[model samples]
Target: MNTDAALAALAALAHPTRLEAFRLLVQHEPEGLSTGQLVAASGLTQSTFSTHLAVLAKAGMVKSEKRGRQFIQRAEIDALKGLMLFLAKDCCQGRAELCEPLLAELACC
Candidate 1:
């Protein structure tokens, strides 16, 4: 991702609630979760949770789709991957050996 996009994603995830929601969505993956489910999990009012979701959407870190009468929210894995790559693009300052350990840890995940 470009610097601006990376910054936006970072800013969106910087909030505790947003980060937690994003991680939760990631755990759900392709199937995603309904808006009500997310609000209940967050223990927040629907409107409050919606604001957080909006931030994530603006950052392209999350997406929602209309499913029947409800909206299903899903984490944007590509956006996350881009953000991660942007952050690690210069890992170990071009020293492959120095970055091997970090890559190994990521591979485990």
Candidate 2:
């Protein structure tokens, strides 16, 4: 991802509730979770959780699909990978050696 996009993604994740929501969504993986489920898990009002979801969607970190009368939210793993690559490139610069350890640790994940 470009710097601007990376910044947006990072900023979107910086919020406590948003970060929690994203992590919860990641754990659900390909199946995703309905908007109602997320609201229940978050213990937040539907409108409040929706605002958080919108921020994540705007940052390209989350995607939603309409399923019947509800929406299912999923984390955009590719966008996350892109953000990681952007940060890694910035940190390593011309020095590939500096990135090796981080890459190795990430591989474990």
Candidate 3:
């Protein structure tokens, strides 16, 4: 991801509700979750949760598809990977040993 795209993703995830929603979606993975399900999980009004979802979509971190009458939202894993790579691109100023620990932690996930 470029600097601007990375910034946008960061800004989108900076909000609590958005971060939670994104993580929830990630847990669901390829199957994803319906918009209603997300709203219910958030314990927020549909309209309010929609605004948060919109921010995630705008940042390219989330995507939605029409499934029957409902929209299923899915986390964009590639976008997340890109953001992570961008952040660690210059890890420890090119010191491989210094970056090993960070890589190991990510590997555990």
Each prediction's TM-score versus the true structure: 0.96, 0.91, 0.96
lDDT of each: 0.95, 0.93, 0.97
Worst 10 residues of 3 by lDDT: 89-98
- What are the per-residue Cα lDDT tens digits for candidate 1 across 28-65? 99999999999999999999999999999999999999
- lDDT for predicted candidate 3 compared with the true structure: 0.97
Ranking by TM-score, best first? 3, 1, 2
Order the candidates by lDDT, highest first — what do you get?
Answer: 3, 1, 2
Shift in Å, residue 91, candidate 3: 1.1
Off by over 4 Å in 2: none
For residues 1-109, write the lDDT of model 2, one tens digit per residue: 8889988999999999999999999999999999999999999999999999999999999999998998999999999889877877778878989888988997898
Q: Identify the leading candidate in terms of lDDT.
A: 3
Q: How good is model 2 by TM-score?
A: 0.91
